[model samples]
Target: MRFDILTVLPGLLESPFAHSILHRAQKKGLTEIHVHNLRDYSSNKHKSVDDYPYGGGSGMVMMIEPFAVCIEKLKAEREYDEIIFMTPDGVTLNQGLANQLSSVKNIMILCGHYKGIDQRVRDLYVTREMSIGDYVLSGGELPAAILVDAIVRLIPGVLSDETSALSDSFQDDMLDAPVYTRPADWKGHKVPDILLSGNTPEIEKWRFEQAMERTKARRPDLLE
Candidate 1:
């Protein structure tokens, strides 16, 4: 998979993709992430990408021209499966959405800063819009990182154990079952006897039951 992130503050995204699973994914050629400075596409003498809103909003709004220039240029080079705009009002991102995007070959993520991007840019170029949650942030960089991480981790060869991603919470509309590490009997806490037993079938059944029970208590909406 390939992601082209367009942001005025590209520096904000440097750390997230430079470490951990995302870095390894890039190293193995399983995915590619490219950050583009939105200012680079600006025609202004100051290289500004934002301006005060036309109606005199309190916050600055990202200019449409630079964004359009960048998106159009990228489109000419390759067809992208989704041109996503990260905004507070977008559809709430979910595991299923991440899974769907993992199959896409190319993507472009536009990070809105200041107040937000011009609506015309969204209407004309964006194929999808996603939000991490209800709360707002100073910018879309963090949300974009989260989105990239979710999609990249699901790509084949990104994780050491390919099936690990399959069993992640929300993969099956249920939270993952409880897990225990070494020192099974730490202090007074003991690992579930079923897990310690050498009965794979029984253990699998127990895990499923636990997962369902936990989901019922915590997020019954998922089951529905």
Candidate 2:
């Protein structure tokens, strides 16, 4: 998969993909992540990409010119499966969405700053809009990075254990069963006998029950 992220604060996104799964995914040829500075597409003499709202809003609105040129230039190079704008009002992102996007060949993400991007740009170009959560943030760079991470890790060969993402929380609409490692008997606490017994069927059943209980206690909404 390929992802092109457009942001005014490209610096904010530098660190998120530089470590861990995402970095390794790129190195292994499983995915490509490109960050474009929107200011580079600015038409302003000072290279400003925002302006006072036409209706006189308190904060500056991102001008459409920069986004227009950027999107057009990208489309000319290759087709995009989705052009996603991260915003508070868009559909909230979840594991299902990430899983769906993992199949796409290419995507474009635009990060909004200041008040937000001009509505015209969204109407003209964006195929989808996504929100990380209900709450608002100062900018969309973080959300863009998060969305990419979520999708990238699910791609085959991105993780050392391919099944790891399949069992991630929310992939099954249930939380994960508690896990224990070496020193399971720390402080007199012992590993569950079923796990130690090497009874795969019984152990799987126990994990499912534990996951169901945890989900009911913490996030019953997922079950509904």
- Candidate 2 per-residue lDDT over residues 105-160, each given as its tens digit: 99999999999889999999999999999999999999999999999999998999
Q: Score each candidate by Cα lDDT.
A: 0.96, 0.94
Residue 175 error for model 1, in Å? 0.5
User: Pairs clashing in candidate 2?
Assistant: none
For model 1, residues 1-224, the per-residue Cα lDDT tens digits are 89999999999999999999999999999999999999999999999999999978599999999999999999999999999999999999999999999999999999999888999999999999999999999999999999999999999999999999999999999999999898989898899899999899999999999999999999999999
Per-candidate clash tally: 0, 0
Indicate the residue-level lDDT of 145 in model 1.
99
* Model 2: per-residue Cα lDDT at residue 1: 92
List candidate 2 segments past 4 Å from native.
none
Cα RMSDs, all models: 1.0, 1.0
* Model 1: colliding residue pairs: none
Worst 10 residues of 1 by lDDT: 50-59
